[model samples]
Target: MYKKSLVFLFLVFTVCHGDIFEECEDVESESFVSSWQSCQSYVYCDGDESMLGECDEGQYFDPETSSCDDAANVKCFLDEVDEPSVEEEPEPEPTPPVMEQPTDVEIVNTAPVVKPNCPNSDDPSQVIFMANNASCADYYLCYHGHAIEMHCTNQLHFNGLTGQCDYPENVHCPLDEPSAHKCLPHITDFFPHPDKCSYFYYCIKGFLTLQQCPFYYGWDIERRSCVQLNVAKCYGNSRRA
Candidate 1:
């Protein structure tokens, strides 16, 4: 009875493990064969002798490639019997908030200024100085009929009357004037008097000198000098006294 029981146990073990090597006998050359029991296990055949082999973790024996391959690429129904449980992935941490920058600083123009051309004039030797229309601290000097752009240092404005850069308080730029009636001290240009047709104000050396035109002539604001009475238009009073 003891011998019979041992023989039965041996038969059971052979049925379970030995069945995998049944196909290996048909393979004449040294090769691998897929096991019927488990996809992870295979049969290595060498002539008439055979042995069981296992693939690496997460791999399966592939009969087509005749080698162990990734389980995802191998098609094995037996792998479903001991499938690994799916694990849940953890949620990502929340992102931090961004901080804003302050906006209290003053914004100033830093671009290079495009130099302007000198005003049209008949007298080339006048050496005229004109204030910049865009910036009070900048001016242009007309030398030999060409304009030389210049900047005033120490935050001073170009004084047309003084023919030099001076403090902003003492300089009256022509841009600040609402009308042409006010004489600009920073320029040597002549301006017509508001109340007199024959009289005009000439800016020279930072001073306004009132001068009268010759007989039968009136101060022409457009001409910037005296002209015949018929061509000159006076804002106030008769064209001729």
Candidate 2:
């Protein structure tokens, strides 16, 4: 009888001190728990096992999001140890330098110019198609006197004569010019182009590429995708007259 009581107590103690694996049993699969020891480290549970994981450098495991996030956004109280206050000495002030003569230097503008509006056609109601002079793979679709930039994928170029995207060998358009636009290093998602509402930048794993929306569509910054011109509110212009 006494031996049976000891066995029951042992089982209770083991179940009470089962550590992270016991805590993970109640959580759903593929969930995370912030580590009490360090803010950067967390425990990822896959229903079968619990594994320790660490966030990237300068990042902290966010308990709210269940993912590693920027340190500025995370409030980590686990690793909040009282830091020792250090006394600092005041530094001496520096002397001012003499002014130098200014030289005349030619300043050139390297900013990308805004795309031209759709050309005026004989009938404003009729849709017009025109080839982009700067790119062979891109063209403009004029809808109701509005310029809608479009591009051809799979190395195809826009054929002005055929009014369609065709093989480069079949088209006689000018050589494509390199784009002056560049993506920001910190931004790794789809973002709208500063100069063009129809164009957006796709950045992933440090590789950057420019993309365009379809006709009567504009890049929506909030939605991170192309939406209708009426819904996008790009430059406060509507799709219809």
- Top of the candidates by TM-score: 1
lDDT of 1 by residue, 1-241 (tens): 0112222222222223343466676686667677754676676666435566666656677787666667888887664554334342555633333333546644533322232455565242245565566555667765444555677876566776666778766986553343754555566766667666878878775688889886456775433556665566554454344
Residue-level lDDT of model 2, residues 39-71, one tens digit each, is 666666665455666665566777776667777
Instruction: Evaluate candidate 2 by giving its C-alpha RMSD to the native, one decimal.
Output: 21.3
* TM-score of each predicted structure versus truth: 0.26, 0.24
Question: What is the lDDT, from 0 to 100, of the residue 152 in candidate 2?
Answer: 87
| Cα error of candidate 1 at position 76, Å | 99
Clashing pairs in 2: none
Evaluated at residue 61, the lDDT of candidate 2 is 71
Q: What is the lDDT, from 0 to 100, of the residue 115 in candidate 1?
A: 28
